[model samples]
Target: MVPKAFEAGYPKTLGFRKVVKATIYVKKKEGMSDEDFIDYYNTKHAQRAAPILQRHGIISYSLTYHLERDRKMIQDIMHGKAQLMDYDAICTFVFPDYLALAKFLYDKDGAALSSDHDNFMDDKLMKMMVGDEYLLIEDGNKVG
Candidate 1:
């Protein structure tokens, strides 16, 4: 059965939150191993960006590397033929509101971040999806 919450449909019915979430798909630059890419991003990159994120009203940011071995295993279990996704990593960021997000983009700190991208990842291979968040679940439980 569709939960009573979801049966109503869409954000308002689901108790929409004003926060926006941006999911970014990105690929490493040529010749960087997965280990090197993850290391540089986790250690050097995030350290540099922390202040900019805090200043821009970003609630949080996280980046996760896509595991090819895990993908292969899942495909094997399903008896499915599959190809790897183009992206090497997925990065997510949360913003407090539209104004916060706009400021994050147009502000000087944002410019610094944009300029910094060339140091590690392939900017040409990046894609982003931005949208508001609604909770259909909180922690491990369902939400109504």
Candidate 2:
């Protein structure tokens, strides 16, 4: 179930304690190997964005690369035989709230980070969205 704070169209303010999670779907540029893409994003991009994220009220950031073992699942989905999951990587970020996210976007730091995306991935191929998390399970146990 969706949390009350995240129920309304606008995120409910709870002393800036609620986190706004942004899920980013990324695609590497042409000729870039998967290893290289993951390396640059996890190391170079993340390193450079560390301070910028802190300044923007981001509490955490994580990158999940597509694994070789998951290739079959991806192909099946792409071929319309399975669920949708067409992305090379998933980058998750937790922010203090939506307002902070907005401030980050308008700030020069945000612009710098936006430009940095060109160095490792294709902007035209990236997709991103922000939403709150709902905990329906924990450590193999259901929590509803």
Candidate 3:
């Protein structure tokens, strides 16, 4: 079942654990300041979400904010090399599998975690991509 140009026993045999990763592209609430958005998401939302996610065996989770000034400088130096994205931040949540992800998202008694989204995130602009992590490199070494 090898794809074109791929060697036999490639990805799965590379010794890396396969995990489901959700990449959430988030936008700040309309008229919300960047500082406030970052602060609330880190100190408020993430704090509240961690316990629920951990209970469901979430492997890892992180948030990365946009660096507009740095990106602009890099783009200027390289003559607009970096494409700009309108997202305020990118959130990554890694789970052991789909079942864990489902539970984390739905098994809760109340929508405490998701309801918190309104505090800082723009619902209309948020997007999520869920898929298996295809690790090609780790610790500067090739794994696949």
Candidate 4:
């Protein structure tokens, strides 16, 4: 989640503008412990990414870990069916605007991000996209 200070003072009473949403899925490399992978991501990788994201005009960045308990709940909901998603973590990167996102995509900073991903992420297992959010409800009130 983004820091409260970063949130705009006014809500988008109109439709929300589209923003880049880079959702990342991590694949733990062979022989690397899960603890090590998470530590490097949270400490070294994420730490390094903050400045780059800021420079690229990203609004917020956050990581969601796939916990064992959540996995069990998924299995239960599926009635012992197949796994819906197989990934260790999901990362969301929000950009201020599509133009800012485009700049990041075509700039050297993007290359740096890609290079860093090579060190800790499996490109083959990754899924990313830029999307707009449609708010159906906000604070229990209907929204456009």
- To one decimal, what is the Cα RMSD in angstroms of model 1 from the true structure? 6.9
* lDDT, model 2, position 114: 84
Candidate 1: tens digits of C-alpha lDDT, residues 1-144: 433432222454446665778899988878887778888889988888778788977888999787566677868977887666878899898876666667777878667877767877999889998886778888888877
Candidate order by lDDT, decreasing, is: 3, 1, 2, 4
**lDDT of candidate 1 at residue 87, scale 0 to 100:** 85
Candidate 1 contains a number of clashing pairs equal to: 0
- lDDT of candidate 4 over 1-144, digit per residue (tens): 444433432355465544556676777555666677788789988887788778878888998877566678878988888565777788888876666666666777666767777666677788775565656777999876
| C-alpha lDDT (0 to 100) for residue 91 of candidate 4 | 83
lDDT, residue 37, candidate 3 = 89
C-alpha RMSD between model 4 and the true structure: 6.4
In model 4, the worst 10-residue window by lDDT is 1-10
Residue-level lDDT for 80 in candidate 4: 84
Cand. 3 Cα-lDDT: 0.78
Off by over 4 Å in 1: 1-13, 82-84
Root-mean-square deviation per candidate: 6.9, 5.6, 5.9, 6.4
